[model samples]
Target chain A: MARVNATPRRRGAARTDELLEVTLELAVEVGYAGLSIEAVARRAGVGKHTIYRRWPSKAALLLDALSRVWTADLNYRGTGDVRADLREQFLRSAPALATTPIGPVYRAVIAEAQSDEALRATLHEMFLANVEQSTLDRITRAQQAGELVPDVDLTFAAEVLCGALYYRGLLSTRPIDEAAVDSLLDMFMAAYGA
Target chain B: MARVNATPRRRGAARTDELLEVTLELAVEVGYAGLSIEAVARRAGVGKHTIYRRWPSKAALLLDALSRVWTADLNYRGTGDVRADLREQFLRSAPALATTPIGPVYRAVIAEAQSDEALRATLHEMFLANVEQSTLDRITRAQQAGELVPDVDLTFAAEVLCGALYYRGLLSTRPIDEAAVDSLLDMFMAAYGA
Candidate 1:
């Protein structure tokens, strides 16, 4: 999304996708700490300015790549059962973050964000905030439909839902499977289910 | 705890404590990525071998230091009201992770653990597993006292509880305040409170 405007109209999106793919590959190979704009350029066969023209920094570039990896698979089904919708979405989308390239690179980016405030802000705005908001949106509709208990604040619930998944999926060494998701959703439903 | 036996006589314990304190100071000052044995040794007024003799790696040293910072707090009190105890313990214990010299340093170590399996195991064994298990212990007593639903798996609940706190407290840029803690417990009680 960052550099989408600069590339030529046709094949531009494809080229951006390819560049991002390469970025992820390189991130996996050398790690986020070792990844550089110069290295990305060299590997992608593009000029350094070309990479820099779109992304302001290495974090920015990798963030975009992470966004691409995450964007496609995260849509919730809203199957009318908020719990089921959440469970479905969780099973579908959460595993990618656990997989290689994304997990390690994402962790490194998160690590770097600890020291770099600007990167932290961007990471939240571009990634985590989106996930959190999408979750809120799903549960909000369910609450309005009376699938959830009336008038209780669900924002923290959303955070806990997504946060638990993210923590288990990406941050920790544990694997989140169907049984785990079922237990989580069961507790969630016991709390919020109407 | 690692190098305690290596030191001799009455001052041995004090020297170990001072070294761990210096390690933490260095972690905060240089950032974990830039922290080194030489840096810690030079800052602590000790030889490099002396620092290395106790901990095999920088991660090992920092992990031990983290153990010290975390050791003094984190006990969960059984007030006969599980929710109150949880809320009280959360308020007392969770803030330290959100504070400087702990939050940032802990995040860096967690990030490093993402790539390093040994570090991940050590972190879980020493730090996170303890937190998770302690939460479980607190909740298990409540369940046995008939304060929670019978025959339900509380392990995932414990994970979600601590994981959400850790996520919001350490990982995310968001602040976990009293209101947030109340909201979290509200949902938890709704789910599990009997």
Candidate 2:
């Protein structure tokens, strides 16, 4: 009886994965503007209600698809050097943003969030806030370790470092290449380095 | 003879202004997703061909509308203080972005550009490039004036300064208020100050 009950739960989880996979595939091919629930359902061979029952809107569906695959490993190595660690994190994550479907999909969500207050808040709570908090934690650790200026508020510093990259990469349409990262780090070192 | 020739020219310019005004009104009310050429033409009371003749696409029409009204005065009031000049420019421009239709419209265009390559290039060329150039110019002048560190690349410095504000104001949904400005300026002073 226990096995019989668990079988249905396992099947449900697999269905969720299949739906999310289909969502990402459609998102990459058609983009946010071109994507729709009917289209996704058609491609996935599932009823539109199946998707709607799970996700209220396209944006919500995309967010889930992104959350599943867009796991940017923010594990700071704490290699005894803050600047190198930051540079490592950025360089390591560059390919995830630039080369993958996550890049375009993520950009679309951010674009949609401009006019969407609720989506914006959800995005912040689900994604950006966590990235920011991790960055802040690393910065705080660096300050404690005497690699950064002690007792000075590093709130703006964290924002600037992360914000500048987002600006160049997303806003300015500039490629966030190695050179750009180096230049950003140089400015960071000058500002926050002990 | 001169007056007769100028009559058509003046009327054409007036008609253009009226069309653009209608476009802004519709954009603010419905937003980018709900906006369309059919609606714009119906509201403007002009035939669809009339708008199509002038603008190849909705993105083009919105760009023109934005360029006309989004005249952010970037003339850095060179008080020989680089930090103060930047702070003044940011603070002065805050309301123009935060309170006006320019803010929402600009955000919409930036959002659309993520999917449209040609539109992205046009936006960068028409708007963001000028802003970045002027910022670089101001920074160069500051470096020359010895108010900032000399011989530094200052390229990333400029991007970071401008980019940070853009990130906070647009991407992160944070207000570019006085306190935020103060914190950014503090980081700038700590990093690049002579």
Candidate 3:
């Protein structure tokens, strides 16, 4: 009886995952300039109202799709050592550079945000806030554990981590590989670690 | 006779400077979206032909105008110490944040660069090359002076410095102040200085 009930649940989950995957593939193919709710609905084989029921606008749908596609490994705790934890986190997340269309999508969004106030606010609230909060949480925990220097400014440190990653992503065409991540971790630790 | 010739030379230089200033002002008001060579010529009180004689196209004119306007003081010589040199260089350049529309203009150019491949290559060659070159020069000098660590990757260090500044400028409306510059220098030194 339990196995029978699990069949429907698994099917539902698979359907949702398929929808998200289709949305991401469309975003990459058309760029953000060509993204529309109706287009996403058509591409995903889902109804316009169905997509609208889950996401209010194209921006909301894009954000939702991004969240589903670009899942970072938040479990970066490694032997309670901050440096190792950061290196591991960066390495795991770094592969998204090749697998996802996140870099180009982010650039397109930022470009539009320059002229569109609503998109700007949405980007700040959805993307920037998520990155900032997660980084701060990790750094603050490290500080409390005496792994980071007592006097290190947690906010600035958080900015440095995200800023470096963002800088590499936007400016360069190269993938953010393990070597770059390792060097960044080493630099950050040398600068702020206790 | 000498006095008359000197007066004419001084006036010509002053007029050229005024034209450049007006060009930047017009760019900010209209953006790259609506900017035209004729408009710039009218705004600067110069003949359209004269503008074209100097620059073949509107893009060329804007590039020349930007070159005259966006001047960073790259006189950072090694003080026989990498940390101090980095600190001084950042401190000196920090105040230009308020005095110039570099951030907005740069964002505009970068956005335009995405679609216009020719303009993109020209922008990289005319503007970005100088920035990268100056940064690498500083790092190279520091390396030669034995101020930087033997294994320090100058390319990565240069990226970290300029990349952080570009990141903040493009992503946020926040002013990059002296304190922020100081913190950045501190971190850079901690990471790369011997």
Candidate 4:
């Protein structure tokens, strides 16, 4: 009786997973310009209304897809070494940024967001939330502990650290290697370290 | 005789200018995905063959259009003062980066460049030329004068300075205002000042 009840729930989860997987694959193959709900529906073998039921718009669907795959292993813990902590954060995130489908999807969405207000808001909100909750708090803690300069703007510091990575990933073909990671952390520490 | 000789040349130049203008406008309105040689030709009131004669592909046409309008007034002459120089550079370039048609066109091409390899090379080449010739040279000069640390990587320094602006312009809706300008210069100074 319990198995019977769980069967439909499991089936629904599997269907949602399949739809998301298709969206990720299609985003790269067709790009944001060529992507559409109808295309996703046709490719995924799901109804258009099924996608709309899960996400209000195509942008929302893409955002959901991005969130699931883009940030899978990005868990940062501060170990009192700000440089090491920041370096680790980037080193861990580098693979997803460089070689994965996440890179293309991120570039596509950001490119789309230039002309898209709704999508821009979603990206900004999601980005700011992550920075505020994790990055800002960590930096602020370091300031309190006298590990970082008291006057540094946490947001700007975060931007400088991560912006180089995003800049390279989006605009340049430069690999996000150990050297790049060291340069980013070294520069951030040079400016902000106490 | 000279007037007659120049008539066709002048007319050809005017026709090319019009086609390029339409291309720039359409890139923002419809984005790189929807932009086409047909649309540009139609909007410019020229034959499709005229556009083809001038540019070999959509990417080529877009690159040509971008080169004409963008970077028109970006003249960076750095003085001895690093803060003043950096601030002036950003100030000078802000109009092109934000207010003009150049911004949208630039954003559009960059969006397109993600999926297009040849376009990416063009962008990187153009970007690297500007940075290496002007930005990196100025920073290196300052370092030599003992205005900045000797060990600072000029390329990374240039990337950090401009990457923040590009990051905000492309990804976030943050206005590149006076405070932001001051913050960028100050941070660079903090890190590299001798």
Which candidate ranks first by TM-score, i.e. highest?
1
Worst 10 residues of 3 chain B by lDDT: B94-103
Total backbone collisions for each predicted model: 0, 0, 0, 0
How high a TM-score does candidate 3 get?
0.69
Candidate 4 per-residue lDDT, tens place, B102-165, comes to 6766667777777666777777765534653567777888899889999767677777777777
Candidate 3: docking tier = acceptable
Specify the CAPRI tier of model 2.
medium
> For residues A1-194, could you state the per-residue lDDT of candidate 2 as single tens digits?
99989999999999998988898999899887788989989988999999999898887888777777756655767888888889888778665545666788788888888767778777766677666777788889999999998988888788888788887766665788889999988887788889
Please give each candidate's TM-score. 0.82, 0.78, 0.69, 0.77
Local error of candidate 3 at residue B28 (angstroms): 2.6
Model 2 residue runs over 4 Å out of place are A1-26, A33-61, B1-61
What lDDT is reached at residue A41 by model 3? 77
Query: Model 1 segments beyond 4 Å from truth?
Result: A1-19, A36-56, B1-19, B29-31, B34-58
Which candidate number would show the highest DockQ if scored against the true structure? Answer: 2
What's the DockQ for every one of the candidates? 0.55, 0.57, 0.34, 0.48
Worst 10 residues of 2 chain B by lDDT: B93-102
Per-residue lDDT over B72-176 for candidate 2, one digit per residue giving the tens place of the 0 to 100 score:
656778888888888888888766555656677778888887767787877776776767777888989998988888888877777787788877766666789
Model 3 lDDT on a 0 to 1 scale? 0.70
Pairs of residues clashing in candidate 4: none
Number of the candidate with higher lDDT, 2 or 4: 2
Which candidate achieves the best lDDT against the true structure?
A: 1
Q: What C-alpha lDDT do the candidate models reach, one value each?
A: 0.82, 0.80, 0.70, 0.74
